[model samples]
Target: MSIERERPRILFATDFSPWAAQAEAYALCLASTWRASLTAVNVLEFQPGMNPEYEVNRLFLAELMKGATQELADLKSRVAARGISLHTRIATGIPSEEILGAARAEDSDLIVVGTKGKTGLAHVLLGSTAERVIRTAPCPVLAVRAEPSDQAGKDSHPCAGVGLHRVLVPVDFSDCSLEALEYAALLAQRSGSSLSLLHVLEPVSYGLDFTLSLERKRGEMRERLTQRLAGFVEALAGAKITADSHVRGGLPADSILDSARTLPADVIVMGTHGRRGLSHALSGSVTEAVLRQSRCPVLTVRSPKFAAGHRRVIPVS
Candidate 1:
């Protein structure tokens, strides 16, 4: 999966919201840098028979599409002015479904979407369109939050003037994490960036009586982790990508976030379990949490072995 070998096709999904606006900046920057074709997608979610107020829904959808179309046109023109070829798409269906459909139709190398960073009840009710896209998109998904506070290397737009200088990847030694590391290395090589592989050791809570035993156990584990990290870096020997490793103690998400801030990472590339339904709700997702809170954009790739089910084909009405 050498993204540099071929011309990349990037799909940018926007709802014309402020969050999506922020994402547009990233889309432009990436497209311009990679010399990739850029497609801007806006979906009109009009479920006809799902509601009793059909007339009201129809009127509202009409207005929504009208506005969305105008906005997309303006976006296309703006992107074109930046010297990147821009294509516009309007589909009527679920946003995630339509966005994924567009990605497939375009054979996109990456799908960029904006997340509102919703949590708690709002996340449950509204759901995360970005997360759904991440779970299902055939290609890697880059999630940009509406607003990120840590704008270390960012220009007026968070992603502006940045070219993935330093990429931080969290590795748990899982197959998924390994795949993410490979992807990150490729990205770093292409962008002339360095890679930082991070592993977080979750502390075991033991009674005071076991303090000595815990200290010895922690030492052994750290030594083992150090050896494993060395092996992982060795595997990328021929890649010619500069890389380093860090083993830290704390929660996985917290540790990853801290590393990103400390490294001042331009981007975070990590793998997701791609869990859904009850499992996802119960276990929660560290990747999703990092995506929600990370100041930098997070690119999530699912393991190839993780069957992404069938590619859903949403009909455009």
Candidate 2:
């Protein structure tokens, strides 16, 4: 995607929870900024053997729809008051499935969703609809979390006082990372923010011996990585985007989060490998860890053709 293109359609999945409310504010702000079409979706999960055709299930479904409709209506009014039109949809089925379907149906360039930010056992046990959507969505996904009580009480909207001052992009020089860098550059250009490119060089200690040879090899690797990162930054020179590069030695996810917090970035834009099932379990996901723990919003983009240089850059609106 050309970095100069605009995002015309944005899909927002909500459950009407406080976190979703916070995400709505971001969606609204983006819609207004980009003058993009906004579509709000709410999924109504259906239980097995609970066909709406049955009287009992029918009543239950009806009540649920009624509440959902009212919530959407209220959301519509709020968005409209902000001078942005909202298109709402209610679907039945799995939350992630419905959200992805809506994105495909709308040809959306981005999907915005709220995450509960659950961690540890709670996250593992319950899983996350936002994470699933991120894994499979055809477009980029923005995961927003509810503001802390202290912060929430001060701001009417989590993003109302926010501006994209600095954007952090973690890159490993993989195709996915390259694509993410392109997107982050465009976003920084549009928002007048600087870009921080971080490359974490995980330590490698073979066979328990920290020999001088191994130390020399590690130093050589670091030098090469630094040069590559410089070249990566140089590629964005013509775009007039201010970018800085950093190479750290540690775990990928930990380094990303630490840089984000220390830089006090407004957002973290990175590429997701979109690993799932066994692969996901075994390899885990650095993007997911950063998404779960980062203080700012995280945008995850997965594109098969992203590295081909044939894709058009969709604006972050």
Candidate 3:
């Protein structure tokens, strides 16, 4: 999708939690900057034991809905004060399922959800909804963490990215990565953000020693790949997007996280695919690790094609 060519529809699936409020700031920031219509949705999670069809349960549900409406109204007013007109909705059922449904139903161009990022422990357990939404959203998904990393908080405010300055995109020279670059270019165009492209190189064989010949070959490979990275930067030249790239040799996730941390990127834009078992230029495993460790929000572009287990073409939303 040409996100630059089209005005995108944005959906913020909020749970009214403190972390969700963090996500709201990002949704509001993007909506205000992009001038895109924003919708805030809250799902009323019905307990399995109580059926809403009964009188007591029905009244209880009514009370919750009444409260939610007021909360959404207050949130609307808050964003409206920032000159952003907000649309609101409340859904009933599973949070992740309902959120995915809402995005599907609305044909949203992007979905933003709040997450609490810390050391492992499943990373984001906003009902584990943030992780699920990242995996299966119809369009790009923005995972906004509750706060910045300790080191980052001293120097900057992660939530104040309404005026983005730098975007870090990890590329592995795959079609999926190419798609991510497209998304990043548009973001850079709109936000005047500089693009940092990273490519990580790993040893081709597990037990091989780095002999003189191997070192020579590695140098050749780095130069070749660096040229390819430059070609990508050249492609963005016409749009006047400031873009530069680098080639690093290490674990993909570690290298990516390092670049993002040192650059203090406002966001990391990359791509993910459902493909498993076989190796691709970039794997879901790498993306998952980056999402868990990065100090900034990760905007993941879903690739239309799949490999291995799920080989069907994904329909555009």
Candidate 4:
């Protein structure tokens, strides 16, 4: 996709929670700014049971769907008046599954979700539906957390704007990281924000093949990162999005957080493979780590269509 192209549409999924409301507001603002359409989806969880006639169950389900549909419809006119194209949908099933299905069904460029950013016991218990959606969605997922309670109470008026002044993008020089950087650059361009490209030089043990000294390893790491950053700069030059790239030696998650904190970014964008089971548990750690510690909102993109020079740059609606 051309970096200059605008975001045409956004898929905003709401659970009707306070956090979801915050997500809707942010998504709607962007839609208006980009002149993009909005497709809002609400996933309803149905009670599980069996009935011979199923009459009562049917009535209950109908009422639930109708209420959600009405709520979305009400939002449509207001959002549309702000220059955003609006559509509403109601589905019954698992939240993550329904959310992903809605994105595919609408051919949305992005998924905007509101999260609590739960910590401690809550974090372990919730396990993060936002993370799951990030892994599964066809497009990028923007996880918006409610403003800190202290801040919210002080200011009755919700914060305004896309808040994209500085964006943090973590890179490993993998194809996935390249895809993420391209998307991030486009977003930075649109938002008129600076870009921070970071690479985490993970420590090497060499196992039993400990022939290379620590100094040699450090030298090798510097050379590899220099080549990577140079190539990245060239790519950005072609797209016209100015960016700063850096290499730091540490754990991947820690380095990502350190870079983000140093920049004090308004947003962070990254890519994931949507892994599951044992692999997912391990791979999901980086995403989990950043989301837990970062002060800014985070966007996660998972694209099966990603390829060198053939990446699809979804507009930053």
User: Quick one: best TM-score, which candidate?
Assistant: 2
Q: Write one digit per residue (lDDT tens) for candidate 3, span 2-29.
A: 3443456789998887777767778877
Provide the global lDDT of candidate 2 against the true structure: 0.79
Summing lDDT over every window of 10 consecutive residues in candidate 3, give the lowest-scoring window.
308-317
TM-score of each predicted structure versus truth: 0.86, 0.89, 0.83, 0.81
10 residues in a row with least lDDT, candidate 1: 308-317
Best by lDDT: 2
lDDT of each: 0.78, 0.79, 0.75, 0.71
Candidate 2, residues 126-240: lDDT per residue as tens digits? 6799999999888788898657343431344424755568889998878788778777876676567888889999977588766899889889999999988787677666567
lDDT by residue for model 4 over 1-317, one digit each (tens)?
22234545578888777667767766876665555677889988763464424898778778888888788777776665555667888888778888889888877777888887777777655667787788677888889875633222122222354476778888876666767777787676666677878788888666666655766968877988877686776667666677777888899988887777776777888877667678765555687678767666788766733234554432221
Residue-level error in angstroms, candidate 1, position 9: 1.5
Q: How many residue pairs clash in each candidate?
A: 0, 5, 0, 1
Candidate 3 root-mean-square deviation in Å: 6.4
| Model 2 stretches astray by more than 4 angstroms | 1-7, 148-159, 206-209, 304-317
Candidate 1 clashing pairs, residues 3+ apart or interchain: none
The clash number for model 3 is 0
lDDT of 1 by residue, 257-312 (tens): 99999977888999887998899988889998898788788999983321234221
